[model samples]
Target: MSSKVYTTESGEVVYAMVAEFETPADVYHAAEKVRDAGYSRWDVHTPFPIHGMEDAMGVKRTILPMVIGVVGLSCAGLGFLMQWWMSGVDYPLMTQGKPFATWQAFVPITFELGILFSAFTAIIGMLFFNRLPQWYHPLLKKDRFLRVSDDRFMICIEAGDANFDPDRTRALLEGAGGKHIDLVEE
Candidate 1:
């Protein structure tokens, strides 16, 4: 059968395959299996994180924090240079003609603006990369998925790459012990 590709509200491609599980353990195990299968964009939704499940799923930490840090540093540096260049180097206005290059005087303003710029960049950069400000997800359309925040646990693998196979993937989830096994079509 031809693969069904789903586009989420975030404009991300997610292959929708639903699995029903009787227990959280089953859900946890299924998530681990899904990850080991090498599906890149995958997620698990459980009432809570199951112990040792992350190891099983082979999940890796996202680099978004590092990206945020670099961008924040860049903003801070730019802010410092802009302030210094404009106030001291570019347009030298003599208030009392104390000193053209006053590091002490510049320190307060520079630090203030640097922190401001860095903080702003960290927030904006995170939102941009995360595609946040979202109020809802297409998963809300799945009745079974609603249980995710409650008693039920779920793992979803996106069809992000060429490796995604809807039919075979569904089979894999089922074989891993998924019960409901619904197809989420975008």
Candidate 2:
């Protein structure tokens, strides 16, 4: 079978093979087949999250929680230190006959800062991990793929994958019950 190729404005010949499935189950099964075939650079898109689809796509758990945990703790500690330095050493204001570095008074601000840092870290880390803020993608040009937001399911295997072969990948997708297979250009 001849693979469709598209030349970009930059004169690059890179292309992506997209297989459209009629149902989420078909896409999920196709993802499993693609994963088992040792193709690492592939993605599944659906109208909504499918049950067990992550395992089918061989996606692993992310480390964003660890990042958030470290950032939050650091911010909380910094907040406590700032409060201590300001009240105990910088200005050394004495209030209600109490010691300047009162741990009790620092608790509220420290907790609030910790929460704020965690929330920020979570949002930033998610965007970073997911590679968001992408205004355009090659798949957006495919007319059939527009239904992915409503009902269609799709799996795209990039040409850059180490194990990618246009004919073999197309056959795999076909065996997995994919329809409307098309080549996407970058």
Candidate 3:
């Protein structure tokens, strides 16, 4: 078995049908309609995260929250362990002659570390899963695509997937009332 090698300067190009819409509402509706048609490898770009657009695209909520939960729990456990080892077992410091393993002192650090771990987990998981921190992408080269960061809403359907057929995808976008029909090439 061999893994495909892609050392090229660009990501594998995706063939897309481009559309230009006069309003954000148009692209939002187009996204919903396109999802209903069942092209799984598609994406929508907008100047902002439009309301209800995620549901329209059939995108499920991310699992990163669950990951954060687990991290938080682990952090709590570890924090307790650290306090136990340092104050109870290792050093056994008798502060004001108070009893060891007092909950009063442990509470703040435990809570702080738990929240810290969860935050770190959420951020790292989001970046890893989304393949972010990336410096470049071919689509960023498209002339009008920059509008997606501002006032434009656009959707893209990737080519080369198992279900992708260039002509058919183009027709579907057209029927969905999409405008422009541009391809992202390497």
Candidate that scores best on lDDT: 2
Worst 10 residues of 2 by lDDT: 1-10
Q: Write the per-residue lDDT of candidate 1 for residues 1-186, one digit (tens) a residue.
A: 225565656775554666767677787778778877877666777777678776877766667677766766676667667766887899977878776666667667666766776678778877886698887776788888988777877767656545567678888888898777765645
lDDT of 2: 0.88
Q: What is the C-alpha lDDT of each candidate?
A: 0.72, 0.88, 0.77
1 versus 3: better lDDT goes to: 3
Q: Estimated TM-score per prediction?
A: 0.67, 0.90, 0.87
For model 2, how does the per-residue alpha-carbon lDDT over 47-83 read when each residue is reduced to its tens digit?
9889999899899988999999999999999999999
**Candidate 2 runs further than 4 Å off:** 1-12
For model 1, the stretches where C-alpha displacement exceeds 4 angstroms are 1-15, 20-26, 47-55, 90-97, 133-137, 159-168
Candidate 2 vs candidate 3, lDDT winner: 2
Full candidate order by TM-score, most accurate first: 2, 3, 1
**Error in Å for residue 5 of model 3:** 15
| Highest TM-score scorer | 2
Clashing pairs in 3: 17-181, 18-180, 18-181, 18-182, 19-179, 19-180, 19-181, 20-179, 20-180
Residue 89 displacement (Å), model 1: 3.7
